[model samples]
Target: HPQNPKPQNWTVALEKYYLSTMYSLEFIIGALGNIIVVFGYVFCLKKWKSGNIYLFNLSISDLLFLCTLPNLVNSYSKDQWAESTLCHSNRFLLHANLYSSVLFLMVISIDRYMLMKHPFRDHVLQKRNTAVVVSVAVWIGVILELLPLLYFLEPVTAANNYKCLDYASSGDPVTSLVYSMFLTVFGFLIPLLTMGCFYLKMVCFLQNRSEQIRSALTLEKPLTLVILTVVTFSLLFTPYHVMRNVRIASRIPALNISGGTQRVITTVYIITRPFAFLNSAINPVFYFLMGDHFREMLMAKTRQLLGRLTTTGK
Candidate 1:
């Protein structure tokens, strides 16, 4: 009897096209915005506050992550994985940026809440020195947390030599699922909960205050920031985590899942990935809105440059 051939998953082809397009767009938009923020911080802004320190770190993280996107875009577009060293380094930076960005966002949330609570900015954590220490600690902590991935991420193994598999697909399915679940809890869930609590408290505090107090404090800025943060998490982070865990679990042979079901899950997981990285593009909005002096200085710099260019033309 002739054997029936297994059905191929066409979603893999879809992923290459989709990711290449999304990543190319993300790299362009994210790079421009992050570069502006970084340039403004380094050149235009003179005085650095605690909040500025945190926002600057966030910009740097985004900029660094955006730098990796071009390479990723090339790989996806060509459907070719990079060499082992490049793959390892690229993936490491990607995970490092992911966790660090979340931690920095959490810090920003806490900083904003404290600013509202202690409007005069007299809290000890509001000090610039304290912010510097906290930023350093966050980088170190993210590195420690992601160090385990180095052992698990093999871009080219005996089984798969051509593709650079993600954490969910590259490593041992059972082990990867366990680690993915752990990250969802510690890396995302905890920080998300903390941000929610602080933002909720900020909202409650604002509501209780008189209209005069709200007007004087400029309630709209922080309110806008809260909305943006919530939107980013809901639209971006949540889906990625859920899909990542499910994708990894489905890969476990013990699960006895049908091939068609696995393919569907994998397609959904692939769709979530670009959204996860979309934060690099979105974080710049936070800088413009929440940064104390950032918007003003950026405008000033823009006007100055225009004036110079006009003079040069004349």
Candidate 2:
């Protein structure tokens, strides 16, 4: 990569080192958090409950996504894509994780709508193959959608003196801008809209039918707050994403980010991305484990583990 007239400040090796450290932490966080979600869902929540199916699917996606993080950590930490083809593929894996998470969230929201509004819907109430099929199909579609990144996102040398990521090495500046826009809108925005709309429908339906609220509110207060938090999260993520792409496109000197203020505009990329990924791990404790049945299952599992520890004399 040749240097543009305006240079980025960081050195490549130093930036790689910093990214390596951050990725190490990210891997650990994702591993432990998503594993907990996966284990709890599989061992305890596998039975068909009103919402557990959606949650279990979400956990599965997160778990599958987390499984690839070590390769990512290795990519930067080892300071070479020489480690394995796996390391080269880690960025695509992460992108697939993003898509998987979005797809599962949509499933959850649609499930919520059905269970709340049309409680007798066979798809919502009974054990069915559609959800499982849909989840698998969704991952397949996401992989295909992200296939181009695999072609373009080689371990390219960075102009910023780092092995950081960018879109295709060859294309119009506006091409990346368009891809980023698509990623933001389809990957983040539309699913978020789906979440918001269906959750709103669920809330309205619940509030209308005194029976559902009476049953749920009695058993779940802080539990209900989990959904509320998710709704709030969706609302907040949209603008951050739009600004992210706008700032990314503006990173091109030709886009004119405020006459030598490109750095500040581009800073949103660094600032907001961690917040988004961190959200994936944040919901486990409050959303699933804190629900009544789930809380009981978690405590039961915790006690069982402690008991095993005592028995093993470790």
Candidate 3:
């Protein structure tokens, strides 16, 4: 008889260990950072800039994503499966935050681009009410996109343990493929393209202006911020989306994937999946590092809190 191949038990163990460690770190960093950002925007800042409104909403979305991390960490670390409702609900919240964060970031990029490229129209377009309306629309749109997950994510029992949102438990391959395609395209690709176009346009606009004009407007720092935001978004999100499509493609019967190939895909998916969650933690860092106005407010809030604490101690 031909020699039988062995399963990659070590690889699976390593992947699980990696996920458990990183998800916990991501949860701590993302939860604390997003809370501070959201609180600062709501309570510390006296007035909200149009862009701050969007950032506030983004932080809330991140916080919501972080809220799901403990359950995820528990599931991955303990290798314990979740109940059906919990599983589908967690998946729904994850996707909702993922897409909403992308959309809000896109909105911010557009807001910055318009500020740089069409300064004259800022008053008409950049308003608090407008941001509120857009934020509402974004929430509604994300909910609609992810609502199907609740219906489709059936519960399963494997090895005498119940599992929710199991890939093997998915109802129909055709339905999964269609839904995954829609998510990959609209959720990731389109928003990515939009942000890219705006960043490119803003860069071109800045380069065309004379040095004196650029300095007078103080465009360099903000331009750098834009570049950083675009780079960060690409770094964190691209892998997840690419590997997601790969996983979906592997499920097709025509592909006739080998066990080893499936193992490779599974490992890659496991690694990249957290990158989506990592986005939540990173956005607050970007705001602190690159956002001048936000940084100042954060500092002011910190000093004020410290002073009050010192007084209370006295």
Candidate 4:
């Protein structure tokens, strides 16, 4: 009777072990992969060009977000906040880094656009100092942008354990809607549109830059990067936003969205949270995977690591 009690304290058919394993893998892969990416961009390449600097900062952002994944994994598995302050700080870092990633990608596209439009002006703003200044500004912007999230996040007990939940309990409905709309729109859609338009124009310019010059450069790459970013951004974020509202709308009896639908949406949202994180995880791989220089550096590093391992074993 007790085993088949009237109300179960926890979820059934949750695949808790499997979910925990996946989260662990996600944390490990994200952490190690991003570290390698940072190493590749910095020490291995040894080139700090404008493009390189942008990519490095992008890598750093990914690395920072990845570092937060382990804490999240632990929280998910234990279903509680091991450290409240750490959790809030991680949320801020992750959110800031993700948004900053969008800005840097937009900047990269703009840089490409500038190069395609006026290659002669490259030296004017492509200097190392210029890259450093831009990187500093991007970081500052991220810090300011994420300052709000710090206040919203608070530790609360749910499912008999403490976890970080947003301050929606006190925040007004209108305020929440406005914030969500802006976050979903400006955070994802606008930068996407800007990148798309700029890249399309850049492609047109590249086509006109004479066959020899075009052939020497991998002109298709710019469009490829745009396509990857578009797919990952849309797939990772769109549903999360939709389900978040569904979760809210469920509380209002007048909303008329069925309870069953909302439950299904919430279940799916929980199941798919990890995939949404791939938006940050996959970009660096896409950016550098096929490039000759990137591959060379990666291979050399792999061999050195292997040789060191072999010597240590001896």
Candidate 5:
């Protein structure tokens, strides 16, 4: 008798359960947090700075991505009846929101850097119109970059069930590898480097300025925001990318990795994957923590909502 094919124990039942729970929690918290942030920026805030524009766009991206979590959770939990079209659209929106969020964060970092390092050029480069144009460009670029996935990422049968957004099951392995490489490099690495450089320059500028001048410049808020952005990217995005590459590398036949190792990689990916989505929820916390104005606006809105509820009850 032929040796039983290595028992495929990659059931991931526990992982799926955790993912479903986490996705549900993320959707509720992320949607509410991002909605508050968007409302604060759009209606409560009197003035819109360049950074505020980027934050608003980021909030929209988070909200849009959070909107898709239910479908994603369903895919993880139930039989995937999602067609190829829905799968492609979900994949596109997921990546589009992710890269666009990174781009907007980079924009915010650059805006803050310029405000501190080259205050003289503020009139030309730091205008609200400039930020709006850049934001539009980012949206277009992310959409175009991910458009190919619609063609390549088709629904495929896995474990006798149809699955959507399962790139590994459907796409050309080489193409998947290339796309992951591009995403990690351009989407993660480059932006990370750029942010680091901008922050370094800002620190240098602060170092050169006199205490009185530095005190007057009052860059603590912007600096805090930069730190939060870096932390968010590091904690959420970094592990996902690293594990993704490792999983891709494990697929190579030359590596001759044991079945057990592959299983471990898959488990790690499942665990770390949701973290990328957590970024959407955590960002609103950052906004509330870092922005006094945002907090005040949120409190005022909460009070108004309570007043209306009490009046309605009476």
Candidate 6:
């Protein structure tokens, strides 16, 4: 490609150290938080709210996604995956987490709206069975949506068979750009907009209700979820999607984008990859903040364990 006449050596060096550090930190922190939440839900909490089911699924997604990061960390640190199978599977897990996280957040937003609409909890959608069915549908939908990635994402690059290149970076630029855009629009933009709409409706609903409802302390969790979703989309997803398209577009032979410009785009795209995955690390915060029952249960469990330890020490 004339646009990228020479390899940008600095990008590789940056990715090697930067992504290794980032993924290592994310894996450790994300795994701990998600694991604790999963255990807390399973062992500590007896009663399950409709929202609890959704948050539990979210925790599962984060935990599974975090599991894949060790492979990524090893690959990035060594500059190659041990095998192509590892490459493909890890990439699959990564994309699955990304799309699934946003979709679950959208569902949570809708769930919040339903909660406010039916504080008495009589709505059909608020039923525990319905939540389970919806969660199942979300997993299946995310799987079907991401199925093409397995085919399109060539695990190894032609230039370096050992290096597992992402679809946008390794495949035919025109084709990669098309598929990336498709994923962005359907997997990200639609869900993000859906979340925004529901959040707005939630805010309106809260405001229009009586002052009793307004002062009921229900605003904190929903508002926190909304702010977190917005922040995650803006800080993490947007730049990655934008720079991915830009990076692939620069690689297309017909575009004739300058070599210098291509380097800048590629560097930025590499940077965004780690930031995008930061969601896995940060998602555990939602479990603590949004689930009142969860927080109380987890704290009680911790206190109980501490009391046991103190008695043992005595």
Most TM-score-accurate candidate: 1
lDDT of 3 at 166: 39
- In model 6, the clashing pairs are none
lDDT of 6 by residue, 114-194 (tens): 877887789999999999999999999999988878877665645564688876676788887888899999998998888
Error of 5 at 242 (Å): 1.3
Q: How high is each candidate's TM-score?
A: 0.94, 0.76, 0.90, 0.79, 0.88, 0.93
State the TM-score for model 5.
0.88
Residue 155 deviation, candidate 5, in Å?
1.9
Off by over 4 Å in 5: 1-10, 117-121, 157-160, 213-217, 289-292, 304-314
Inter-residue clash pairs, candidate 4: none
What's the best-to-worst order under lDDT?
1, 6, 3, 5, 4, 2
Which lDDT values do the candidates have, in the order given? 0.84, 0.60, 0.77, 0.65, 0.76, 0.83
RMSD of 3: 3.0
Best by lDDT: 1
For model 5, residues 1-314, the per-residue Cα lDDT tens digits are: 02323333234464458888888999999998898888788778887767677788899999889888899888877745576677777777877778888887887788878877665545666788988898888888888877776665766556435656444434565667788888889888899889988888777777777576656468766777788788778789998888877777777777798877877786787788788778888878767755437788778978998999999999
Worst lDDT window (10 residues) for model 4?
Answer: 6-15
Instruction: Give the residue spans of candidate 1 off by over 4 A.
Output: 1-9, 211-217
True-structure Cα RMSD, model 1: 2.4
Off by over 4 Å in 2: 1-7, 10-22, 67-88, 118-126, 151-164, 168-171, 211-213, 216-232, 251-259, 286-292, 308-314
lDDT string for model 3 (127-191, tens) is 78888999999999999988876665666466334645434236565677678778878988899
Listing every candidate in turn, what is its Cα RMSD in Å to the true structure after a full C-alpha superposition?
Answer: 2.4, 4.2, 3.0, 4.3, 3.1, 2.2
- Over the stretch 217-304, how does candidate 2's per-residue lDDT look in tens digits? 6434432653775665665465457666666667566756573465555444444544455545654654454343776787699899
Give the least accurate 10-residue stretch of model 2, judged by summed lDDT. Answer: 162-171
